[model samples]
Target: MEDIRIRYYSKTGNTKKIAEYIANELNLKALSIDQNDYNSPCGLLFLGGAPYANIMSSKLREYANNLIKENVKAVALFTTSNWSRRTVRALKKILREKNILVYDEFLYVHMLAVNGAIEKTKLFVKNILEKYKG
Candidate 1:
């Protein structure tokens, strides 16, 4: 598998939980946006966030905007929200604007109810791993 990095911006920890789960399965540390730097290259980047009123945080937008295509090859998005998958869509748009490939599929977890988050995340991660494992 190629080196993968997981980063997220979470206001209520719901997104964080999902990010952590993805990282744990891949044996990597889940990094908050504040902790992650874009100085290094990675094969795939898993970015997670939640939007308020369908508005993505400026910080997260900036991160997506500054993502160097040479450094981060591609992105897979995920979100945790009450009912909106807006963040995932927003991130995809931002990344694609810069010509970065955004995986067609994304993960979403209900913010208030994550009863099967791990299992769902496992399946998501499995598919991601398989795709990149080559």
Candidate 2:
């Protein structure tokens, strides 16, 4: 089994908390999207962020645009928004241009508490593990 990494972009720490919770649940390393090494040999990634001004975070948007030679095969996008699907749509469009498949399990927490994030992450991870493991 190849390693799956968790990467996120956050400003008010909401996305960071969700990312960390997911990473802990899956026992995977969580890195800031800015700090992710494009050369790393990861099978898939859980990319997360919080919407800023109703758009994807600038740094994360840039990172997704710049992805070229990475070994990542797929991504599961997670986000926290008041109630907008535009973030996922924007990210999906970007990833489509790069030819990276976005997993069907794209998750978004509607501005949740830390414990809420953890619980949601647990359910998401469980489904992902089952899909990949099966």
Q: Which candidate leads in lDDT?
A: 1
lDDT for predicted candidate 2 compared with the true structure: 0.78
Across 28-70, the per-residue lDDT of candidate 2 in tens digits comes to: 6788987857667677788887777788878888877876536
lDDT, model 1, position 6 = 94
Which portions of model 1 show Cα errors greater than 4 Å? none
Tens digits of lDDT, candidate 1, 36-102: 4876888899998998887988889888888878888778899988889988888898889878888
Task: Give all candidate RMSDs, comma-separated.
Answer: 1.5, 1.9
Clashing pairs in 2: none
**What TM-score would you give candidate 1 relative to the actual structure?**
0.93
Range of the 10 consecutive residues with the lowest summed lDDT in candidate 1:
125-134
Q: Per-prediction count of colliding residue pairs?
A: 0, 0
Model 2: per-residue Cα lDDT at residue 69: 30
Question: What Cα-based lDDT does every candidate model obtain?
Answer: 0.86, 0.78
**Per-model TM-score versus the true fold:** 0.93, 0.88
Top of the candidates by TM-score: 1
